[model samples]
Target: MLPTVRHLLSQPDLDLRLLTPATTLPERALEQSVEWVHSSDLSDPTPFLSPGQVLLTTGTQFDTEAHGDELYTAYVARLRQRGIAALGFGTEVIRDGTPDGLVDACLADGLPLFEVPYRTPFIAVVRSAADMVAEERYARHTWALSAQRAISLAALRPDGLSATLSELSHQLHHWVALFDASGTLDRVFPRDAFAGAGLPGTSFETVQREAGRLLGRGQRASATVLAGGETLTLQTLGRRDQLRGVLALGGVRELDAASQDVVTSVIALAGLALEQNHALAGARGHLRAGLLHALLGGSRDLAETISTEMWGPLPSAPVQLVVTDAPAGRLDAIIEFLELRVEEQPDRLFFATQNDRVVLILDRTGRLLLEDLCRTFGLHAGLSDQTDYRDLPRALAQAEQACERSKEGEAGVVEFDDISRQGVLAFLARTDAREVGRATLLPLINHDELNGSELLKTVQVWLQHNGAFDAAGRVLGVHRHTVRSRIELAETLLGRDLGTFHARADVWAALLATASVPG
Candidate 1:
């Protein structure tokens, strides 16, 4: 603990009395740095004065011997210009009395003056100040070590995570909570502090990003909780600064430097505990990556493996397959976020890619859960039917295809089956893929579209009507002669008659191909 100013003043070896002095100056005067001290008998002490110095001089220096009776008082103006810490005068050198002119000058100018009487050597006083500060630093370093040991023991005890945190809080005198990667409060020791409170705490998704930056810059952070009144957050980082957790102190008194160290040590210990927890949970986590690979490649065994290992033989292994548009390592954090969210549920499982596209699994209906996950993790997901593992790959494929069709799909959410076509949509999707398809009919479409002839429109209308020309003309809003002229013009461009079934089929396929290509 750092010694207070009162402690230094109370030192026995320094027999200093406050001459012309009272007890303490106002609190605002504490911030000044000491500049220099001198014991000179010159009448013009003001010339030697510099800003921030606690000028030490004998009382003779304040005498009006050479200058007028207002001489000592005139130094106040120069002292104010110097902005010194305080003027110290040895009372023995000037008859143990402070000059009235100096006293009056100080009160008028607001310059503090200290009267250093006999029996206390200035060297002894300076030595006492140095010793006090040095002792304070030593004490702080020792306390830091003791706290460090406690942190080490906190990680080793393994008595439940809550017990460890309780021990940690006792040592640091603060409330501690271990939040998993999910925003939910996984463990809050001394549960009474937040037992009924809906404040589950913010997620590592938010905290880690911030804590990581602070640790990266070799800085410690602290904040007051506006929501919880005196509640305060004093956080730094833990083991390799992995952002294990945050330490909070809620009290009316401000935390001292020692308290800050204790809280930081607790966070470091909590980091180790959490990393251990993660290792323990890794086996359960391995399925997510495998699930992602399986869904992407449409592998059956991978899905079955996930089902048997995670949500075994059940009535309905309700699941949603999310498809991410990224490759790898780019979205590890989002995948981790999904994992943490799923971990909260009794029977939820999720697999996601590095690009943040994901598949989430829950036993019951997942509309609420999916919405929560999307809002929490900040990733849009294509919701799919909750079927058994057998259908996951297909659901994922549909979601991905739907994503391709949605203009805003890259925003990272898409649902399969919803984007798929039916009837004319389905026919249009595959219209140009048939063997007697556009590869053989492109020349026909090119011929009609390039020539600006109405033949392509006529054929499209005729095909819609199943080859009924007058009906097609009615749909086209043109006369039969006009439609026939367009067809004749199309035939002329194609160097083939439009009467044959093969020629008509070619024109139909070409039109489909032209429409199917994404604009």
Candidate 2:
């Protein structure tokens, strides 16, 4: 490490002594390693001074009578403002000694002040600091090279990005995270360390906003955030103003140039990985679409052969067709997420996008993955019954219809069977169903409108109660006799027998169909 004030004071040959009280000097200040030394004969040296430097002055300009106490105090304050590690005063040049105003100013500001005897030359101090700085730089170079090698080897592992991040986290002894362009957390080293570090509640929103802005510009940007009593640095991952993602590093430490080089290399690798994945996804999407076309055209044998070569043997019996929809803004993210899932488990599914919807031919058991994805992405999805590859066209139609129905109902997922409607009569097209519903209820609707009778309410309540007059009456806040009379009137007006289960079922379907229609 570079030499600090304490290190210089401890060198017996240097003959340096602390003029500031030991109690007054903080441990952080004493441990600060000086990067260099600056010797100035001028009074105002703030412009020349930099951080992590020990300022050396011979007190030749310390004329209390000429400069006044206030001017000396101002000079000392300026040195502190420039962030000098410490101030060294050389005695014997001034007629008196170190000015009391300078000493008082250093003490007030907690700036470490030490005295240099005339016997010691400032050049000696400069030499000691330079050697230490060079040694530290070399050490950092060695460590960075080793870390880069380790990270590179880890990236070659089968696990790829996860393994690379793990190795980096281990080497730095800090948490590392990667986020995709959509601002989703793609991976985090040490598992749940990000949450443990209190980052989610502290700076997650800011990070997401900045990440989105940087990604749009395809540029590199960074922000420093404080969380869990430690600093985190969030940086964009890109090259030449093309951003693919963002990276987060917590418990940040000052990195040397060599270490920063390793970071740049890692960022490059990550960007390349993302680009390759995107290209592969596009190619796979085309293949999946082609496969669907073959199956829909009744070329089952060709489809199966291609499927076997790419994603293992096709299910001989039947597979489920799933359709998914998301908002236009989130459509790309949802598609990318599905593509990743397909790549990770190729045999489980194959998917392609059609317009605003994603269609998938997946094993029956893959429903859970779709359900979870729907919830995660706030998507609406529809699933069809298992159908043979030969019947994929029909199955796809069913799934598309279900997906649209789910979206209309604002449901997360809708399975073909969940609607409990079989064959063509289950539910017709929107206009047809509305017309049929209006016809079915027209007689009773007109009667109630003309006579202001409670027949429609009574029939609906009776249907809910399964034709039980007493239960229906209780729900309607009326007596069983009144409910019975209302139901009879409804039956007369509709010219149907409400006593039969099939008849009531028909009326129930019509009621649901008209529930969403205006009178």
Candidate 3:
């Protein structure tokens, strides 16, 4: 321990009289050698002492009566130029007091003045300075040890959580945990220290409260554990964004100042490492999503990647197609979660998230998985007819149509045939171009005003039977001649012949269009 100047002057029994009480002393640092002895005897003492050295003085070298002011002025100038550490004047030889001019000079030069009492020994002052240095070293060493232990509390082995947490618990001598944002333990130390702490396995929302706590006033607080018979101090181990975790340390040493810094570094490192791993995995998932999109976007076959990999074979696949996205913003987590669920289900051939929802081609023998999926995902699904792998596009279209129909009115999953009203009622819903082509034959539909005109009814019957006059007469409850006359009247009204199949088709189509229009 090197002695400081002020500490050296505070010793007992040196008989050093107080000299310059008002002189400004220069700053003093520790001296490694006894080289300060040479400067003690010089007339202009400061020129011999190194800059920053503490220069203690006695007035023995100067002839005060004849040369006092000149010698004093020279000494002050040299002290100022050399930057001596607070020139101390022992008054024993200089008339028991520092000269006023020297005091004023020291003050103007901005140096510090100390008055050493007659009872203090300069040697005793040296020993005291040495003691202070030793104490400071001890304090720094203690702080460093605490820092090491704090870091160890958050470290782990590559094996997994149990080993890491157990070691941390032992190091901190308290239970420690790395919880997801949900306050559910992602990992815990001491194996059994955390029994059922409600760590969420699949969602971070549950731990958001804990995360918020760590971010706000921080997790540092005193915990009274009656069962364990120990009081623990909790410290948040990271900044708001980095590795966020609650650190539990036993015995209330309070993690010291150095430990906090160490914990900050450790948490930052953990956050970085975890994020890097997540980013890499996300990149892989992105590649897979891109590959799926390319397959679904074009005419390319997905045979080599789809059933061949995710599913063993595509037999009797109980497939469902879905199409919905959150209206608020783009769907991200929900989409990924649903896709994961497809793989986890009991029997799924494979799942593809194209057109917003998963199109699950499942093993028909295991149809129960579908119900479970719908319940879990809370999404509407369009179950399609189990078809061959090559026919997936057709099945997909049917499922999409069903979903569209659901949007039309149902507000739930749709079936392919549920919206297929066009089969039996095709003519009722004909498009405008077909309806316009039949406009010329509308006159036959309105000819019932003619006398004894079974003509309109006959035309209707003939059109209904596809121009079969015998069937038309049977349907009309009349003879073939009556049916023929009606057809002739219909032809006359329209100024056209209705004897042929082509003319019959035109009249029938017109009657269909007239029936479909709003009355």
lDDT of 3 at 134: 62
- Kindly indicate the candidate among 1 and 2 with the higher lDDT: 2
Instruction: Write model 3 residue lDDT over 273-297, tens digit each, in one string.
Output: 4455446545645554554455355
Clashing pairs in 2: none
lDDT of 3 at 165: 46
Order the candidate numbers by TM-score, best to worst: 2, 1, 3
Which segments of model 2 are wrong by more than 4 Å? 1-3, 7-13, 66-72, 93-102, 141-160, 195-220, 238-243, 298-318, 326-347, 420-426, 429-432, 435-452, 458-510, 516-519
How would you encode candidate 1's per-residue C-alpha lDDT over 257-319 as one tens digit per residue? 776766666665566666776675455456656665665566756665665666442224666
Which regions in candidate 3 have their CA more than 4 angstroms from the true location? 1-266, 290-318, 322-332, 335-349, 352-359, 365-377, 402-519
Which residue window of length 10 is worst by lDDT in model 2? 422-431
RMSD of each: 8.2, 4.8, 17.6
Q: Candidate 1: deviation at residue 32, Å?
A: 7.0
Tens digit of per-residue lDDT, candidate 2, span 118-222: 777889877877777788788978888999999999999987777888888898777778888777777788887656333566555555565666667766777
lDDT of each: 0.57, 0.76, 0.51
- Ranking 2 against 3 by lDDT, winner: 2
Give the count of colliding residue pairs in each prediction. Answer: 7, 0, 24
Worst 10 residues of 1 by lDDT: 202-211
Number of the predicted model whose TM-score against the real structure is largest: 2
